[model samples]
Target: MIGLNLRLHWIYVPYLSSGRSIRLQINTVIMNPNLDDVDRKILRELQTDGRASFRDISSRIGVSTPTVSARVQAMTDMGLIKGYSTLLDADMLGQVSVILTINAKPSHLEDVYERLMEDEMVRQIFILSDSRLLCMLSFYNQVKYKMFIETISKIPEILSMDASMILKAPKENQRAALTDEAGLLIRCYYCGHMIHDEGVKIKMDGKYHYLCCPVCSKLYKEKYEKLRKSA
Candidate 1:
């Protein structure tokens, strides 16, 4: 099958007393596996409400409940649907949130990243194009926040660190918008290569697997079987 570009538009309402909402729209380009219209509809419904029931989606999308369930399961197996989560408000929980921009020496970038990952206060991390690390951290109070910063200051690999307190978040959206041009991209299960076309699909151990070529497919199957036997 060929690739497709999908566009998705949805409304996002944050769970706050501010009585605010935002309309999010974006065009998503999905590479490597083919997704039909039915699949797109299912995704749109789920992205709008992760807790939406199968029957609810079926009624809205004009599909059967079984079809919706099966399609969701298939997409989940393909690693397209990671999982669902509930968004929580840090401000409501009386937590101090801070954004930390850390610049580490090129030679010790990975080491510094791992060190930060071990800290319980770190919530999220992103690597910027300039090799700087952007970290989102949360602490219960100012005391804990100060202690955490003091500890991080001693890390020799860290060249510079800047911290900014988040006073307020007017809008927060964890869900991504899908457009007609958006498609889900899947990688080869064995080689980790992006699949541009309909690659070989294999099902083993009740799980779906995709491979870029026949050679990798054979090798992956053999390895899987050997590991299963050893287990």
Candidate 2:
């Protein structure tokens, strides 16, 4: 945990449900902190029940309470484990989920991104190839949704945008596979995205990591080597 410096993405999104809208702030930190079998077990248990006490985790993982506490504290200190929180039902709250795709000028990518981040209704943002953006948005009613569209239209370099409602989501935040499937599948070590045909596979810290692209692969190798040399 000593050399860990993770990327924490903060999102402030609107939860629209039952014609009511509320703000929901979410932070997802992706970190690669040399985790072991015990650490993965602890995380699995925590994901199953975040309210589970250290004593309960210790019993499940077959470790002492103090050991579990120390490991959890280390991960927390490293910013890998932010905090324990409960999930709320957005549909019950009158919130509808939609995915917004936008095409904009390459020069305006950064500016348009910053502008989009200003709206609390924008939950997650992704900049695809060629200045295309994919965003997750939530809105309460037609008035607000139209207002959002009008506001986005005012952006000078934005070309077009398409919004699609998410009717159902079987999995939202489930990251870890139920079994040891990492080896069978190609995944990006940096962003944890599933990699297709194009990727860079490299060995780091005595383990193999496949990055989704050259950029992430280069960054991961440089950071890993720098940390290894310093250590």
Candidate 3:
């Protein structure tokens, strides 16, 4: 059986100002990053076997070697494909995974975020409701974990912190999945023109739509309001 540690703490602190605490929201859109099926297949193959050669990928995906290479390069340039790395076993390294939930002063949200990002032990960070943060950290043992906690406590912005130990991790890092559906052709919101490349996409009224260019995308909101006004 996989062991997991879960902890929760409820604590209240005094508010310093009348202004409400700022809350940060992360973009969790699950779209295909505006790429076609061929690109998606290339990404899926590379993610499955990072060391796979271009020739091997081409053989499996039924594309030319040069085409595969070009697609990979384009994805990298677009920042969709970050640099690859090897996944190591934490048990073999005698390490334990811990999740940390922190409450920071409203004034120090950005500072705390930047500092946590720079910490090598932190694997991931999440912004939560109102100056709150969650971080995943790994350490060799409890002694190291305590030391790291004490170090982080020194940060003036940190108001409170809670920790949960991960006894068993069934799933850790997984890449995005590829779908068989074809990508939608982008069209301008204003002029209804087709976008060949580098078009803008925006979400309005809980739906996402494409605008052929930056200018149209920027002005689309006004167009939406006018349409509403007319109706």
Candidate 4:
């Protein structure tokens, strides 16, 4: 059971896809920095166990110990290494692990954020472009999943929402995807803020919000079009 503490807030950006050249997209991955084969290997290894030592990572990746240390240090310096966390067993805590894709009234965002954070079940919460909020819930079972939907609906700001169960996880651990190329940036819909991106980092409505590099661009698409229409 984790919730928001109001520590995160910023100007929002939306990530969208276009037929433009790939170079532009690469520029958008600034937050993630850059990587090479060695860096990629280091990242892959770190995902399995974040607590792995630098010397161990160096030997495994066939790089000098100092080289591995420098890469790891660079990643942290660049803010790519968000942090290391332990995966928990939600079931043992009287909760079930579930995924939720939310759609809410745009204006009542703070209200929505507050409501979701009130629950101890939401270990993670992310806001998406199309006026949606995504949450991983810690509840008893599917029944609690449904109850979550019902409870959120009580707020008028919550127009509607749907959720699903995570059956299998290719990568059960959490870490930013590293690559030589860049990833899309996203916005936290709650406060209209930018979220760092790394390889399609955000999702909503069973669809990947991979098209845009920033969440605000997606959210403002209609506004941009409306202006063009009036012009």
For every candidate in turn, the CA RMSD to the true structure comes to 16.1, 17.2, 17.0, 14.5
- In model 4, the worst 10-residue window by lDDT is 1-10
Candidate 1 has an lDDT of: 0.80
lDDT of 3 at 45: 91
Q: Write the per-residue lDDT of candidate 3 for residues 44-147, one digit (tens) a residue.
A: 89888999999999999899999899878756643457789999998789899999999999988999999999988998898999889999899988898899
lDDT tens readout by residue for model 4, 1-231? 001111222333333565443321212222332355777788778887889998888888788898888777656643556678787765456666778887888888768988889888787899888888988876777787777677777888887777787765555544354555644244443334555432222234342232223434344444555776899
Worst 10 residues of 3 by lDDT: 1-10
TM-scores of all predicted structures? 0.79, 0.60, 0.64, 0.54
Number of the top TM-score candidate: 1
lDDT leaderboard ranking: 1, 3, 2, 4
The segments of candidate 4 whose C-alpha lies over 4 angstroms from its true place after superposition are 1-33, 91-94, 141-151, 165-175, 178-231
TM-score of 2: 0.60
Cα lDDT for residue 72, candidate 1: 88
**Stretches of candidate 3 exceeding 4 Å from the true structure:** 1-33, 175-231
Q: Note the clash tally of each candidate.
A: 15, 6, 1, 22
Instruction: For residue 41, give model 1's deviation from the true position in Å.
Output: 2.3
Off by over 4 Å in 2: 1-33, 175-231
Q: lDDT of model 4 at residue 182? A: 41
